[model samples]
Target chain A: MSTPRPLTLIVNGEPRALQVEPRTTLLDALRERLDLTGTKKGCDHGQCGACTLHVDGERVLACLTLAQQAEGRRITTIEGLAGPDGTLHAVQKAFLAEDAFQCGYCTPGQIMSAVACIREGHAGSAAEIREFMAGNLCRCGAYPHIVAAVQRAARALEQETLA
Target chain B: MMDFSYARPADLAAAGAALAAGGMALGGGTGLLDLAKLGVARPVAVVDLTRLPGLDAIQVSETEARIGALVKMSRLAAHPAMRAALPAVGQALLASASPQIRNMATIGGNLLQRTRCAYFRDAAVGSCNRRNPGSGCAAVGGVTRGHALLGVSPHCIATHPGDLAVALVAFDAVVETWSPNGQRLLSVHDFFLLPGATPGQEFALAPGEIVTGLRIPLAPVARQARYVKLRDRASYEFAAASLAAGMSLGVDGRIADLRLALGGVATIPWRARSVEAALIGEHPTPAAIAAAAALAMREAEPQPDNRHKLALVPALIERTLTDMVGEPA
Candidate 1:
């Protein structure tokens, strides 16, 4: 059972092959095997939202997901949100402008979750944003700022789609 | 987490064989993986059940709703027609875990989820009977707030910690399972077992059997239903006490049928049969609803810390019924 098996993961639009033990979490695979450390490990378990990542376009807790379980799925981390030209995503830009974080520890997870919230049409208002993004815990008490950023980004993204 | 080998079974036979070889079935891996990391669960071989085909379909017919075991929690919660048909199912699902978890957790996994007792999760914590049988129940005396009052034994008092099972029990859902012998249908009420003396044996799934799907009869009571979850926070947390109610009233203002089930207050998703029996054929009032709800907790044995649930459960039922059906003048 301790033996490592090879598995290919399509992360950030590129397929990367790695060997991982069946017990190795997807969070560890991203940080240790691929050096995609943008995804922080808060609890290294599912308790904290620090390891939330997109699996096949849906946000999921990577810490609870086995690396082998994600073999056939497309995974997107915090690093994949920005463009190759280093252009920040709308949510990222809003996060920076609104100072949606204080210590910036939970920022990556917050931003990734905010992106999905808007994409899922759950960022319609302050209350909606708060309810939808409740999974990403911000211990810095930046919830008000986080809500404001989601609202700002949601409007901007809507305008971009309209434009 | 201990190292384990993984397998993807293409069909039921392969899954059965995998289970026969001492492999634990992995659904969304939310509960199992979390427990494995905590050293609560250690499976030498892991059988990934998500990749199995024909088990992800969500079919709603005129008379029934069949939800495959592999159907993600969010997938069913977001189904428009299903939501309109069986509202309690969606309500319970939405009231459950965070959006990120709902996206990954499967219905089958939710049904068989382990208790959320802190003693069960922490390896170095006080003695936990559920984690290691006969170790002694830590929740019995220490921090008994979240412990079960409805189905408590000296051995275990762990709450079921699931909302879907509560609503399924209310609407007469059937547990559909598959094994080498053939398909078997067990009522949701009988699927879950009480701790009694053996807290380790929780569910009624036979060895090497797999839960294929859940069959819910679209009873008339299901047409009008409500789920009220009272928790510390609004979302992303387990319920302190939750109620799922489905009621139908005749034109004469008398109750035609009523169904009730409670969560977060019982060891299993508890169907309040005595409560339902008291309300049937009678017009609902706040006082009558209050008294009827009391019948559900007749056998409750709450500790000093959790005695508040005695007042909370009846209030949830009374308020939900009053809001659903106006008092008969």
Candidate 2:
């Protein structure tokens, strides 16, 4: 094995520095090294979006991203969504209100993706939401509720922006 | 994944030098990283191309649209200029994999994505000719519902799992690349090699050659182009059979020009020139479209489980053409 290299990323608005192997994926760096395990690793491959997170405000599959690629970039995992005072973000609150999860394994990634979807203005309709959120797979079959939660969260985010 | 050295080169010359030494060019890493994880690809070094400047520009003019190879699929699909110039390109990209994937997958990476054959993906399966040359193809006799039907060789029948290449081929796009020999341009048709005896040799690009950009010449009928993809699910899944069709109508309601290409039915993105030839000056009636569609797949050779593609290919072609001409679906 090669020597670990020092890498730095502005993760969740904090400058995080860590030593990582060249092959360490962003998903592993977040979950294993940083102890932010909210991003799940379903399928490990890019086929499943269980490791979805935001890189510079765009939703990307963390498992497919090498840690070195995230260098000097802002990465927002599900752990970073809520306020520092433990106040759930609007999307999290909407997901809770809408009951958008069952087993909840895929919820973190789904919620992360949903927040980005709303921010990107792709949550205009339920069908559009489903099309955009197709990356995150929920085996528990909470798609209908998940769509509802995204709609509710989009509205809340809009109101928050207005207020 | 294997332990390999990674180098992020900010210049094309550095990336080219690394690639010339047998290091793999890493773009987005959506597909290559997964293959590395599966042990299908074992590179000694990875040349990261993300930091290279001017490789992600999308310039659209009156005559042609030049898209950087590193442009993300999501960005290209949502670009208003591309939508106005070439709707098929956007449609093909949007009809592809899911959103998060689209955000990370590069245009060059999409064109060079590996086959999604079950046998090829599972390196442990031990019988994919593409994965291990001369090992024999497991999909030939095993489960092959998704195998190629048009350009299948006895050695391999894995379908090319890309929608963008199909649309590019239909529009006659040109691929620009930089290699050890400097810069060059290749037509999309000549870019993807047919999987014959050497199923592993999928691209016409030389070792260490990095695709830099793609140029799609604009046509009068480009905005009328349509990409129709039929998959198992409405989203995220690979195409079962897809069609990228475009046409321009003359004043007399005749076909002025036409372009057609098929996906998920061939070893490469299959250009339907036969269908295009049959419809080029003919009035695009239902019978004429059916005849042209029939000509499109007349040379199809389907295996045991994939005979449905023979019918599906022509049906998709006819439907796509009909829809392109503003006929009722």
The per-model DockQ list reads 0.79, 0.90
- As a whole number from 0 to 100, the lDDT of residue B299 in candidate 1 is 88
lDDT of 1 by residue, B1-329 (tens): 88788898888999999997799999999989888888889888899999898999999987999999999999999988788788989999988988898999999999999999888878887577777888898887788888789988899999999999999999989999999999999999999999988888999988889999999999878878878899988888898999899999998878899999999999999998999999999978777888898787888999878999998898888888998886321
Docking class of 2: high
User: How many pairs collide in each candidate, listed in order?
Assistant: 0, 0
Itemize residue pairs with steric clashes in candidate 2.
none
TM-score of each: 0.98, 0.98
lDDT score at residue B278, model 1, on the 0-100 scale:
97
Q: Across residues B1-329, which tens digit of lDDT does each residue of candidate 2 receive?
A: 99999999878888988998989988999988999999988977988998899989999999999999899999999999999888888999998888898889899888889999999999789898898899999998888889888888999999999999998998999999998778999998899888789988998888778999999999887777888999999999899999888899899989998888899989999988888888899999999999889887788887888888888888888777777667521
In candidate 1 chain B, what residue range of length 10 has the lowest lDDT sum?
B320-329
Measured by DockQ, the strongest candidate is: 2
Write the residue-wise lDDT of candidate 1 on A23-73 in tens digits: 899999999999999998898767668888899999998998999989989
Candidate 1 runs further than 4 Å off: B327-329
lDDT of each: 0.90, 0.90
lDDT of 2 at B5: 91
